[model samples]
Target chain A: AQTVTQSQPEMSVQEAETVTLSCTYDTSESDYYLFWYKQPPSRQMILVIRQEAYKQQNATENRFSVNFQKAAKSFSLKISDSQLGDAAMYFCAYRSQSAGGTSYGKLTFGQGTILTVHP
Target chain B: DAGVTQSPTHLIKTRGQHVTLRCSPISGHKSVSWYQQVLGQGPQFIFQYYEKEERGRGNFPDRFSARQFPNYSSELNVNALLLGDSALYLCASSLAGPTGELFFGEGSRLTVL
Candidate 1:
């Protein structure tokens, strides 16, 4: 069994600034996937970014990037030039990539961090 | 191409009643997964179906059942519902690969009274 944790229950950032949300996971498997998802008040869960365990290069998507520390089992999301629309509940998720296993394809998610971007 | 789509955006049911939620994967996707999201919490995995076969299941009870059709559409049925069952039901779709990235749908919110 795997578990993800987000120690920060709430976070706030000023518009046009940068903020980072923290996440950690406990998994014995080496090959897997890590993801960040954002859910706004509209209730739509949108994929923010993803990091493959084998890849050391951090993932970047415009203003959203990830600092994935595989050895330390930490994956954090960094939002640069934040905007009001960035306010939402962000979740860290994990998925196993093993070819054949009972837990394959299921995502274990962390308790979300509600982010508030103040103008 | 439409993203994963789910039906019955919101509904209310009494305890012990039965409820069924539906999902349609992205046009070319062959894998569909279901998750439950309690308020103020992250979504929890419930089940996953690929090519109309059950590929994975979470720690949820037997009251939660789901299936995928030949066209890759899926349904989640919950029987003898309890108040604890009240939550947002989310459906996600992915490609054939075991580690394909998942695309989520706007969930179906169920309120069990």
Candidate 2:
């Protein structure tokens, strides 16, 4: 079993500033993927960024990036140049990359952190 | 390209009643997964189907069931609905490889009374 935890329930950032959302997970599997998803008032979950456990380098997508600490089992999402569109519920998710039918297309998610961006 | 789409954007149901939600995956996408998002909570995985076969299921009870069709679209059926079942049902679709990069649809809001 795997579990993801987002300690911060809510976060706020001024427009054009940066903010980081904390997330931690407990997993025994070595090979996996970590993701940050954003859900706005529209109620659609949008993928923000992804990090591969095998690579030590963090993933960056335009204004979104991640700080993935494998040993600490921590993956945090950092939003740079935050905009009003970035204000939403952010979720930290985990997925197993295990082969041979052990798992498939299943994502375990954290409670979520509500991010508010203000100008 | 159209992303995943769900039908019956909003509906109301009562306890012990049954409900069915439909999803249409992106064209040529053969994988469709369902998730439930409660207010103030993250989306929870419900089921995943690939190539019209059940590939994975979550910790939900048997009353929650789903199936995928030949067209790669899917349906989620919830029997004996409970108030706790009131949430946004989301449909996500992935490409032919690892299901990590998922495209989601605006969910169907189900309110159980």
Candidate 3:
């Protein structure tokens, strides 16, 4: 079984600054995917960025990027130039690569970190 | 394109009652997954269906059941609801391919009294 953990229960960053949300996971599989999702006040879960375990290069989506340490089993999300709109609950997720249709895209999520971008 | 959509934005149910929630996948998406999010917690996987077949199920009890339709839409049914069952039910959809990202809906909030 794979499990994701976000140690930080809450985080705050000043506007125009940067914030990094920590995430760690326990998985025996070598091939898998890591994802960061954001849920705003509207309660809609939005994909932030994704990292493929095979790819050593961290995933970057504009201001949102990840420091993916596969060997350390850590995948942290970094939001640069944070804005007020970035205030939301962020969740870290893990999914194993589908093999022979065995495990498709089931996501195991972390407890989540509540991020507040203060102006 | 419209993202995933869930019906009954909010629902109130009594203990031991039954409830059904619906989800419409994004256009062209062939996979639909269900998740439960309790207050102040992350969403937990409940079920996943692709091509109108069950692909994966979480550690939920038998009271929780779900199925996909020919149109790729889905329904989640929970019987004998308990206070512990009160949570936001979310629906996510993705293309039927390896390593595809999921698109989520606003979620249906269920409050069990």
Which is superior by lDDT, 2 or 3? 3
Q: What would the per-residue lDDT of candidate 1 be over residues A59-103, giving only the tens digit for each residue?
A: 999999999999999999999999999999999999887876554
Model 2 ranges off by over 4 Å = none
lDDT of 3 at B92: 94
Worst 10 residues of 2 chain A by lDDT: A97-106
Per-residue alpha-carbon lDDT of model 2 for A1-111, expressed as tens digits?
A: 999999999999999999999999999999999999998888888889898899999999999889999999999999999999999999999999888765457889999
How does the DockQ of candidate 2 come out? 0.75
> How closely does chain A match the true chain A in each prediction, as TM-score?
0.97, 0.97, 0.97
Q: Could you give the CAPRI-style class of model 2?
A: medium
The best candidate in terms of lDDT: 3
Ranking by DockQ: 3, 2, 1
Position A85, candidate 1: lDDT: 96
- Enumerate clash totals for all models, in the order shown: 0, 0, 0
Model 1, position B56, has a per-residue lDDT of: 90
| Per-model i-RMS | 1.6, 1.3, 1.2
**Cα DockQ of the candidate 1 complex:** 0.70
lDDT score for residue A112 of model 1 = 98
Error of 3 at B103 (Å): 0.4
Give the Å error, residue A85, model 2.
Answer: 1.4
Residue-level lDDT of model 3, residues A13-119, one tens digit each, is: 99999999999999999998899999998999999999999999999999999999998999999999999999999999998885877546589999999998889
